[model samples]
Target chain A: MSDEVKDPKDVLICRCEEVTLREIEQAIDEGFDTVNDVKRITRAGMGLCQGRSCSKVIARIIAQRTGKNIEELLQNSYRYPVRPEKFKIFDEEESHE
Target chain B: MGMSTAYYLTLQGKRVLILEAGIFGAGASGACDDMILFQSKKPGINLELAFESLELYHALNVDLKHDLGFENYGGMVLIKDQKELEIMEEFVQQQRMYGLDVVMLDEKEMRKRQPHISSRFIASTYSPMDAQIDPFHVMYGFFHVAKNLGLEYRKKTPVVGIEKQGNGDFRITTQSGEVFEATQVVNAAGTWAGEIAAMVGENVPITPKRGQIIITEKIPMVGETNLWSAEYLVSKLRPEVKTEISEEHKALGLGFAFTRSFGGNYLIGSTREYAGFDTRTTMEGVNAIVKQAVSYIPLLKDIHFIRAIAGLRPSTPDGKMILGEHPDVPGFYTASGHEGDGISLAPITGKLLSDMMCGAPSDSRLEELSPVRFAVVKGEQVQ
Candidate 1:
């Protein structure tokens, strides 16, 4: 399966952020194994989707590379406003309530 | 703070070990923005140390062999009214005398640099010296390099107790009941520095100032340089200049700092509230920050904010970082209470603390930043 892609750099894991598999691998090689660490260094999951799209794939990649259990790796915290939110919404009269 | 100090110590050929209460970058180091601002600093030791720190960052970018994401993206402090302009003009003059390349820009110049800025801002102060670096990269760069140089670290090992042994060595007990001994112990704990100092019977007044920042989705660059409002600085520098500030804004301690990250997201911030140790992002803070940011750059109003992060900045009473050895506690040192300037001053703090520990001839100017200022001398507190 790994041989299917001759170059990990060509594999785009995070479509929202346009992060490639090679970038994630490089981050892991540099000792940023956790999803959050890689997310910070590579911006793989910090985009419009906020890791919803690429976190699992990145975790699997880390697990495969680092030989760590997928469950053992701490996941990034799920933050508020589950979807993308506009700044004006907060200023709305209803949001204040 | 601990990691960078450890890195510097390792560079000095000292056997260093770091005991962290949590994982790396779990605290303010990870949660804060990447600004290494110069305009925000008062023209004093803080500014002096910031200049030295920026130089060190350039060297570290090469020495660490990693992209620290260091960028010389200049900064601007927007002035809203005649009152703010008056204060900022004097402030800029003082900074200019201190060798900072800063200038007061008219509304035309400000708009030429930041087209998205609201027309309400009458003027701004621009400084090309203002810069930023990715905190995570810098932190981990120190960690990896120092580890390669024989530095050891134990994550999740919170120091539960500290005691001086009869043999003059310091004994440290971790939360996991592990014991370690060292001849010298440096308290590089951020907000928890006070607690760590108390364990050794030293007094260090470090409070946690909660700063909340919101992240926007990847978008086009709104301005040429990082942005800050003189309104916040006015309130801090000249409290006599009465301006209509909302109760919500006051409570949240809302301010504006807008910077685009390497990944192209605008890291808009922030609030400065004395919320103790609560690092939770409040709805009020997020709303205030968004409103303040939109007021400065109306283009941000339509942007989608994806996440809100809060960090507890280790604030001191005087706003200067506490560095140097305790007066009575020999072999004990502290390098904390940097508050918002932690990222800006991390490298210099580490180098200076390491130099102090190594008994190297140090700068006399650093005497002003000593922890001895907070020490109780003969039942009389020293200012």
Candidate 2:
């Protein structure tokens, strides 16, 4: 009844670049406290899916442990540019007055 | 210059190019309440401009002959308190000064005019001239007309890079590694105009303001008079009171407003979040919007929410437009950052931008809407 839940070593959340539970725990041990900070250290959120896969688990873990409101905590991060432009086209016609 | 600038430019002779970062009207111009009403703007010039624009919309509806879906279904703005009623009354005086005919109606009058509204409202201001339009139809109207008139447009291209050449023309670079040499460029990139300006060493403080909306399924009396809270519109203009939502006013909230668009799609908006380029709707935001909107029109309680989306309005440090030619740049002109009013004033902007770029005389009203003011401030800031 008094046992701590051990994080599954093989459980992986961020599949794009292959981040595992052990790695997340290691970053947590290294004082990367917030979801943003953990993502920065481990690149957990900067994958093809852009944190969508790992954010919820990481947010829940942080919220439960940190005693923060999960709903409010989830709203903390800012999403930007929405689209990463791989290409753009412009012309001198548009550049001129 | 006359509207002939756009006409003649397309007519004659030069390669008339329109720089669209996306599909025509895909930007903030397409994303607005599309209220052509002067219900909430300051009296005097602002209301006059909105009313005149409303009239222009009406005229265009007749001239364009049903293509634009120009609507004149009359708008009703509900007021929950006399404080709001006072503002409408004051604005009426100013609208009268601008030759606008507005009616200051009481609760009974308002209820008679728009019975769908909840009786809790103290009063409502109905501008007989207020109207709506299908934004897509109107924008497509412009694009279709422009296209048929032989104006060339490039899509999915951003004017990211620019070089001022010795010939006093511009060499603009697209993200696609394509460069085009054009003698004139119009910075109508909507919310992204500031970033576009930066490519040309021009600084435009075009801040992107995210306005989100929730559409409710067609439910009768959910509201009428294009119902909106006067407090929301007022708070939007006054900085000190902008976000100040008292505990009592939580039902209304800050910057909270709504407008029932045509087509049975209620355009309930908006929360002005400064979330740059994040168009995704958050549950918190949607919930807040629904809560506030329902509070104003309790009838909305029964209405089911269909969907939620967001549009970024290009808001300047000052709330007005940054139009006209670049003050220092020899050949660059801009018509951007009308913020939430972009849709309301697009025709005027397009007309004025064409006039200014052709190096001809412009309407005096154009001066009030010039980007040169932003340019001058940019000049001072950069120095």
Best by DockQ: 1
* Candidate 1 CAPRI category: medium
TM-score of each: 0.93, 0.72
True contacts kept of 2: 0.00
Please give, for residues A1-97, the per-residue lDDT of candidate 2 as tens digits: 4444365775776875578877777666544446665664555765545676588888777676667677854635454323221111112223574
lDDT digits (tens) for residues B43-136 of candidate 1: 9988988999999999999999988888888999998888888889999999999989999999899899999888888899999999999998
**Which candidate ranks first by TM-score, i.e. highest?**
1
lDDT of 2 by residue, B159-253 (tens): 67888899988898888888899888777677887877776778777888787776654445443456566777655445354344764444323
Q: Estimate how well candidate 1 is docked, as a DockQ score.
A: 0.63
Q: Where does candidate 1 clash, by residue pair?
A: none
Worst-scoring 10-residue span by lDDT in model 1 chain B: B374-383
After TM-score superposition, the amount by which residue A50's alpha carbon in candidate 1 deviates from its true location, in angstroms, is: 1.5
* Quality class of the docking in candidate 2, CAPRI style: incorrect
